[model samples]
Target: MTLIDPRNRYPRPPFKTQPQDFPGLSANMGPEPDYGLDSYQSGERLKGLVALITGGDSGIGRAVAIAYAKEGADIALAYLDAEEKDAQNIASSIEAIGRRCLLLPGDIRKKTVCVDWIDETVKKLGGIDILVNNAAFQHPRKDLLDIEDEEWRCHFDTNIHGMFYLTKAALPHLKPGASIINTSSVNTRTPMSILIPYSMTKAAIANFTVSLAGSLVEKGIRVNSVLPGPIWTPFIATGMPAEQHESFGSQAPMGRPGQPAELAGAYVYLADPNNTYTTGALLPVHGGMPQL
Candidate 1:
């Protein structure tokens, strides 16, 4: 029998830059990420539902938005204003799939914006049944000095606090049998020194999911979190240092980074109507990464 080597998966020394900024574009990656168009058999698991997803413009969020649409759900996608191009791409794809798309562009870090967007989504979509708190911001700094006060605050603001703002505003409108899926990270399990603030925020997210799940489940609104490994998204190429980019996800046990499309199924599974018993769980889609 022949043996296979794990390191061969998407060999590093990556080819991507032009947009050397945070939340990189998928179009520029070496092997363009699979957004499930060529895969993901759909059975309309979420038929006739409406979802509000933050960070639905790119990466995992983008994949989830498209998958939800294919599963027969109308979507209200909230993304940063700067990600207009990526957001438009998602919107077009969703619309093409015969699902309605309401694109809301704003910063979730602002409480008023998050609250206002939820109102707009409810008004346009008629009601909210699924909420994907997926938008996040992270900056890796090797030294403490490199992490400024504002950067630290931004991490909590965008990661955890923004989640609170959006979740609180959307809570009352969420009907029975609803689902709330929060996008967390593997960093919560194994904290990265450079990403201390990001790790703290992720830990808080897990706690929030479990605690909130308890309070909401009785009302028929379930809550869960997805703990993902190093997914090959623009979030890395743009936020990480140039030299580090090539070796971005090589540290995972699988010896490679995951693609955004790979994580879509977990979100879909959690949102499925049949998943009435699954809540307060942190589902990890990290290729061989230890969640505990």
Candidate 2:
């Protein structure tokens, strides 16, 4: 067995300044975010289950989708039409692993899109055993007044509202022993001044996760959130200023950013039926970043 030091496992500071437009594609990212295409090994932990993951085209969502598929779960990926290339690539990877993959491309900000995707996943992939509310929007503004009204609404609409819509839509189809995982951020606790809107939504997501967990426990549904710190993904490439890209994950004590591959195991553990007692938990996958 080989032991790897977590601190230096992934790329560190001085990242290339390759910024893209909003909703950036991982394909264009320098040192492209790793979505477990090669490193993750399957344990067949979630065999024969079905999962619906928003933003499954790239970054953290892509990692989770691939990990779930490797664990023997059929996947339904929901992403934007603009991210079709990334989505298609992930779908192919999942299919290559001998798992079924369904692609639903649309904006999650619309309630109709959220509901339709759930229905389609049920109709096509059997049923939803895991619902991952991972799609989100973020834009940094140094001044609160500089955050436009539309931008503020966009943050909440894409983050919390979409999660609410998707969860409500997926609940009925999710039977006992189902898992609902939301992608929250460490900013919920250590809010970034410039990321006011995005950080606020993350805080709300954490609360929603805990509250939903209590409400669903009696039904045998597990609800939880994964709070990630500064992970190297397209979020940084597009959301922050080009100058900030160089030191992206340098703030973390680990001195490096986490790759999506690093967080895949956490989702797998939460979705495993054998881990029945672990619910309403906020699993922190930050690299030595203290959440509280």
Candidate 3:
């Protein structure tokens, strides 16, 4: 399908058609074809499972939601109110795959909202088999002293605090074989000069994953984290400066940014019941970011 921006004066190309080939086109492109349309195919790995994912409206969350649907699991999607349209679209896509999708719009930053979201997911889906704590926000700061206390608090509230709230609320419903997958960042390892608060939260998420996994092991619940290096998502355009967005993900060893589709497989594997031995593990999907 051809996705043209309404504001653009020129015609947009079809999905999966390379941008390089259409030099004359000057439109604000839609989602990369690989993430949105081309690369996602159902695999039924999580048949009969139920999953609740925060930020399942767009980007990595949307990719994971579609993947989970394809894997034969029902999804309860939670996102901020601003993303309701995107979340509904993803719900429609999940339904097209013969899976049920429930959309819950709220801010994960509020403890009460987090509790309610988890409660609603359990009520709608019966019980949670996979809990994905993936909602996050970041504000870039160039100077360390320029960072305000409010921004620091907001970072913790959105990234780490929300995860804690949702996890605590869902723990009661998550059964012996349930899995919790948190999204960390490559910036946690290779700190970015501009995103101190964001990177700190990601590092804390890594630690939280480890501690949660250890605590849940006796109960048979698994917790693991995925550290994504540089994936091209709406966050890049909305969170970073225009110059950074123009060349986002280009610095990776792969010489290109990752599409959301590429990370969905990892989430499926971690969430699958068949693989029960792994927990408290950190999987780095950073286009070959060094390990040492």
**RMSD per model, one decimal:** 3.0, 0.9, 7.1
User: Quick one: ranking by lDDT, best first?
Assistant: 2, 1, 3
> Could you tell me how far off, in angstroms, the CA of residue 133 lies in candidate 2 after the best superposition?
0.4
Which structure among the candidates has the greatest TM-score?
2
Local distance difference test, each candidate = 0.86, 0.92, 0.80
For each candidate, what TM-score against the reference?
Answer: 0.93, 0.98, 0.88
| Backbone clash count, each prediction separately | 2, 0, 0
Cα distance off (Å), candidate 1, residue 161: 1.3
How far residue 38's Cα lies from its native spot in candidate 1, in Å, is 2.5
- After TM-score superposition, the amount by which residue 4's alpha carbon in candidate 2 deviates from its true location, in angstroms, is 1.7
Task: State the lDDT of candidate 3 residue by residue for 1-292, as single tens digits.
Answer: 5554322312122223223221111123354424443456666889999999888877788888889888899999988887766776778878887999999898888999999988888888888899999998887888999989998898999999899999999999988999999999888788888899999999999999999999999999999999998776666655665556555655765656677777888898899888899999998987676755
Off by over 4 Å in 1: 1-19
- Writing each residue's lDDT as its tens digit, candidate 2 over 38-123 gives 88888999999999999999989999999999999999999999999999999999999999999999999999999999999999
